[model samples]
Target: MSRRRQRVGALAAGSVVVCALGAPVAFAAPATTSEITGNGAWVAQAYENTATGIYLTPQQSDVEGPARAPFGSGSHRMVIGESTVQTELYRTPKYDGTPLADITRLEYSTFARRTNGAGALRQPTFLRLNVDKDGDGDQDEQLFFFPANNTDQQAVANGVWQHWVVTGSGLLNVGGDAGAGSATTLAAYKTANPAAELINNDDPADGTATTADGGSIALITGGGNGGGTDSQANGEYFVDRVVVGLDGVDTLFDLGPAAAVQTVATSGATVTPSNLQGWYHEAYDAVDYLDSNQAFVDGPGATPAGGGALRFALSTTTNPDRVELFRTTQFDGTLVRDLRTLKFSTFQRATGANTTPQQPVYLRLSVDTNGDGGMDDTLFYAPANNGTVAQSTWQSWDAASGVWGVNGDQGNGSVTLAEYVVAHPDAVIVKNAYQDRPGGGVAFLVGASGASQMNGEYFLDDVTIGSVDAATGRTSSAKRFDLDSVAPAVSVGDARVLEGNSGTVLNFPVALSRAVPRAVAVDFATVAGTATAGQDFTAASGILTIPAGANSGSITVKVASDKVREPHEALSVKLTARDYGTLGKAVGAGSILNDDTKVALELGKAAKHRVEASVKTKAPVAKATVKLFRVVKGKNVRVLKDELSKKGRLSTVLDEQFEKGTKVKLFAKVRTPHGVYVSETVRHTVR
Candidate 1:
């Protein structure tokens, strides 16, 4: 079928939802904007088929699922039906106007079911390329690849995902007036059609576009409307991770819902939750997995609302260890009776040794009910005891409504937060530390006992806590902590200074990606380069401590300078911090620019025909070769050249006879490992 003939207007307003490959057909609530679009570079335009809505959907298989989840937490689902030519075309102008000769690879992944049905033999979609042959303003050719027609494509079934290559041999076939036959390869197509250029309908109103406001490469599915096998196909297909290769660079489009699309955080970045925002991590006697754990990850059901979730690990195998994330001063003295919302999201994986899956961390609140200066009441909400826990997916719990266990109120029937608050109306969060116990605060605790939980990893995110006014039933404020795995990365900035005659300090600024609760110490030392330490610069090595809650520090090194005309020199400063933070760009470069500029060549009176030549600069010349040359036949011919005079001065006597007014040039050259340093040509007369 000719896809170009079916081009139409905007997509119809509606929504379509589908389950993953093997899952049963279930209707989901309409997708929000966040779940349908991610990158603004792409747009969906429908033709022939009646699409409720053409956008990205979060309903996708996990990373370990049948489909290769590439960019985000979802994929681009195209709803096809009995329509003769149903097409939900996704386009991007990013590669528009690119010549076919520069394209090296074109690939995409699609999910399809392998069952005996009307669309069993039909491929996912046709990879179409709108071409402007002969460089005209109008699109004249449509080159496309039908995976069903290409024998090189994978023939596996069983309801899984597969990849299709559209640039290699036996892939692309020309359509329309270009004739109908396999183009074999992109290179061959470009050779035969030398004027082939990718033309996209990226902007219809622009009047200059050969296509529309869409894009170049169109992901088309559902061709020809009919109940038969060749035309209409009754199936839903998912397209994701479209890779477009142009001029040796590949750009991937991670198709997913819009609101849920977020910038995935760096895995092990140690981020200190902000205190001003009512969240912070307190330093406890636990091993901080700054480099060993992930702070952000993506998968189906990995994160609750977005493409990223927090992954952290705690251990009870050794000493008591748990992450002590706390809210600063906002909840210090708040009465537990006013607490309204308390909930968090977690992802628990299946356990091999036990039938029941591992439990998530606990939500604890240190309360003082007896009016004592210390916190005597500890209330905990355990996931294993309160809610229905599951494995290998994300789930949330309303800790406030669930059962809560107090220090002395732990029986078979643990009371809820509402019941405990009603009994102890005076119970308030303690704000002072007492007897090694952190006073009156909320925290997530795990791993103090039990082998079943020992050495197990856990993921936590979207922690929310709020208070309500009982009289008005109004929520005063809700605080949510976005727990992430990113740790602070330490790096040093480059420094430059003039090589002074004396000690000159070169300050190199050290920075961290984020501040931490504990002081960070980084060891640094100057390494020798073109400039030697203790000679050109002072050798320094020591620990630089970045105080807690600070993100920057500096290191100073004294550089020595001799006032002699020489080329600029450089040295390296290396940093190492194994216990504090991860090293980003560990080494900083130092440049010592030459500042001395004075250079002179003096001619003195001599009794013999010999003429004296000496070179001098701001400082005493040392081991410099002096050369004397006189113009001969328009070219300066070398007459005398040697190191220094016997008296240890940059002086040489020219014995060659010359006219009194003859103009000769004196040159001085100094050789070093870096490069040769030569003075400006000093013209002197041989009087």
Candidate 2:
């Protein structure tokens, strides 16, 4: 099958690239759509060649099985970078009109084979992306460091597929193996640098000097220093499905194929009644009550209409034996303090011909206002007014009316139910203790006073506690609304970065879906990305107030300054949700690009007999390899080399031949995770 096509200029969004077999494709979108024919690939640039080891193929082998093509259908891409994948020239425009800086995530499939023979360590292949993420000329270098001896390395290297989604600032080796492989599924990995920032970048090769033009994607074997020494780049590896998100991506495009959403779904603060809180019952001369689930009771078509219901039954006990269900622990002075009305649904029936109904049925709610050993306030519902009833049936209560029967049906001590609710608004404890016989703690079946053992059956459903509304002075809705437990949405502006030594203020906005009657305060903290707290920027934590009826509020986070010359860095400000509304995950990114003039070690004649070399880097470096070479016919021939001292300083005595001033020169190379940085060769005669 012959597949040849002519292409000119930079690759466009819809430019189709024909593959030798299977399909033809473009780089605009995911290959899931049928419009993209054949396989996974884009028309590579004419200048790109496999001989230099930067081989990028859309698909390696289109096998018809799940074992291959883990991306989607057809073939997945294969990217082999033997230290020659240019990072500056790959910056092409996209369909969404998105630039690389707006990207959030990049994901791709990669695998490495275990080395043979003893001490067979898995060869570490550095996978990274987001080259020049800040749109600055310099590339923010992040290394996905794979441990040489991971426990799951064999399985991953043994044909088991793995995927990585890169994000985070300077995602340069945040640590650990990307992930282990699974037989039935493709292993997942986070290829994004979480702490990626323009700050604390230790490598100068990642600076402007190395950019092809201004931007490009970089994937290479081993960590190439751009001056040879890419030893780790020689290993055999399988990499396909190249993806990159400028910041964070979801639909997968300019963002890498498998990157997760840029922002996480937000949630509001919530207070829900945990199950097993208590639907309790006790036996006093009474064996078992409803005995339905041996816990509470269940019935059909009850009250507020949810599903089923709970029925309360009593055995033939002494007239007024009393049992109760307490709202203990649940009423621990938080969202609910002084509840106005304790609503409930109940059904009373008369058995056979005993039309007397069961007198004195008393249901009461008490509040421990002062936490003083006993309940200081009480509200009781007495159905004794209606006296007795005839037939047995189901009916709704405490729903629309917010009361058991009628108003004025409750009283405790001269204070009526309405007055008690207003008095103890801050009660610490509330209980449902229907005084059975009137002692310190009365007997069970207090409602069935002087009646037969089984006075028919009384059923209760949808028992709720309605608190007094702060604005309306009464319970707003009978159902007490589920408190709208949905999590709140959160967003932080993208432009909150520190420019140089200006010490800009990083502000995070906190907003709510609907205006709350009461003010909601959220806490904010400094989260480290590539930038570290105390070192790169100042660490801060405080409250952000969203006043009543206000949609948004701001938290002003203070950024710091330093004299260290480094690459552009990133920092994140996090917001914490408290009592009122849900706390959302709104992170404000802080970028700190170097504003000071960066200086590298200069090697040249310092004295009449000795050559002195000195340097100042992004951070402290150790054991730097310094080379002193003699210029022989324009070729650099090594004469002698030594490592720099702790202060990043080097001094050496030149060869006897150089003592005569042949215009000899020397250069220094600093090894870093991104790659080795070669200094500009200094030409000077040494004695």
Candidate 3:
């Protein structure tokens, strides 16, 4: 149908005219309540054969379902770049030929914004109804419902959603011989032109139903050649949850994208910047980490809570103008007054010889204070302006609590959050107009033109924001974003111990590459190689826990000692790490050394009555001493005692006054740095 109208003013000369000639896509067949199911559509039609430049698309950005529209997953957006031409989205309804008195409720939700240059033009899309005034077969009269005509100027603020009801409101009529100069309410208009009946046309595809043949309702925006200069102005508008009540039943039309969960929600969600998903950054230089604007980095100067942090940089030579890092597709049109808290940890360092402690970037919010598409002002939370900033150390900012500087009115150096709210009550985060990038709703920026020392590197982590319910005023849990790159890798070190007479402990060191905020646990079990579980060492199996904020811990295994001389035994402790971490050196090898000693004693054949003895052990003997005794009358008597050689060998002959069948006993005692060792006693008889 013809969905456009001309204003009640002189037509401007040199006007650009556009015409839509293709076959229009048919809307869903009319029912009790007609709804725009999938990506809702809009087509251009001319008033007096002329149309404006209109752009319509479903918003693809992350928008909270039901919270924004109270019905749909997304919203349909329409932009009017040029004025003086009218465009609209229309639907054919089943309530055609019904009386105007039968209509009960006619309302829809709208979000409208203007550009930077458009001044004092705050009107959004208007609703139109085709009516048959004289009960004739043709529908000749057009009824227009303007939201600006009913609501106050404050309710028309930019970036805020508003619901308007037009069923019982006044409407302007521009019909045959009824000049557009006069405006009257629906009651007065129906009284003036009695017997007004709705018109119905079943065929929408044949292009036969014109504006005069009324079976259609349309949501229209954009100005025409008439009505004052302000009537034809540029604007961006969104409409959703269109409700039409006929007779007694109400039909709700859910508009916009299909119902599905996106990657991130508008609010009450967390994001760890391991990748660039749902984030926007501009590349400026050849340096990979710094140029990409957002990078994942680790080590000492990175994340204070361990793992990795999100990195961004500003340069004096490459990007000397301005640089900003922001969420790619999140937080658009979020009200500033609804925010409860905003915080994040930052590690700052400069690239030049400047050693003064400073932060490279500050928090910046591009706000639409006047409901325009351009940035009306910027709210800056700078560390230098609020408090002290440290270099090469992680520092957190209470962004929501700080006094922000307002850059809109030539710099209000200290504007409290409460004061800003009172002045710009409907201010919201928006995608600011920029030549080089699609600036995000919320972001961190370095205005290098103003701040000369902004040439530095910065690391951001643990970014969190809390929101409060506008109706209830209750705060919600903070949505935390931990910009982590990788998990910590755990490893175990080998250990060695000497087996003693009593129990000894073998300590295996377990360590992580970096410290984290949460405690890390790994299960470990001792595996036997040559050492038996109970005989050689105590079998140990349990979860080894590394405390939060600590990098190292030890696992102890008890070693059982004995006097038996044997080879060294080996065992291993294997580690299995849990989630949020990985294994590095999975197994730790352990060795248990033997500590027992051995000695030998024999008689020498070169000399008569000569005795030789030697001592040997895993440990070197410091000194050795041998003793010789003789048994007489069933009593032992000491005969000789002498020190042995360095090799622990002793050889000595008995005194001359020895007789046959004489009983003698010899034994050797050896001393080492560890302890003393004694050999078994030997019995010999002189022949």
TM-score of each: 0.31, 0.25, 0.42
Best-to-worst order by lDDT is 3, 1, 2
TM-score of 1: 0.31
Candidates' lDDT values, in order?
Answer: 0.59, 0.39, 0.59
Please write out the lDDT profile of model 3 over residues 1-687, one tens digit for every residue. Answer: 122232111111111111111122222112322222332333333232143232334212323433355333456565555544444444445567778777665777777777546566546767777878887777677777777656532356566777776665544555421433465677676677778866653323324453332235766666454333554356666776666666644555556656443223333222345445466664322112133456666633435444567777666676654344555436667677667678878777877865544454567677777677556666666666556777788888888877665552112245556446544446777776344455576776543323333567777777776665444232344466666667678999999998877868899999999887557789999999899999999999999889767899999999998766679999999999764467999999999988766555554322454433333433444345555555466666666676756665556665543455655565555554445565566776656
List model 1 lDDT by residue over 1-687, tens digit each: 111222111111111100010112222111111111244677666654333322333222213223434334456766565634555676677778888888875877777542335444555666788888889766787787776666556663425657677776645777721323444567788888887888874434324444464777787765465465643266656776676656644555656554232222222222233312444444233223212233354333425432345555555444334333343455777777567678888775533444434667566777777667456566667776665667666788898788765652243445666455433445787654423333336765544424434455566767777764333222355666655434468899999998766667789999988776456678999988899887888999999888766899999999887857678889988999855456888999999998764556677655454577776544444555555555566686777666744333675667877777767665555433323445666666666
How much lDDT does candidate 2 score? 0.39
Q: How many clashes show up in model 2?
A: 57
> 2 or 3, which is superior by TM-score?
3
RMSD of each: 27.4, 42.0, 18.7
lDDT of 3 at 341: 71
Q: What C-alpha lDDT, on a 0 to 100 scale, does residue 281 get in candidate 3?
A: 62
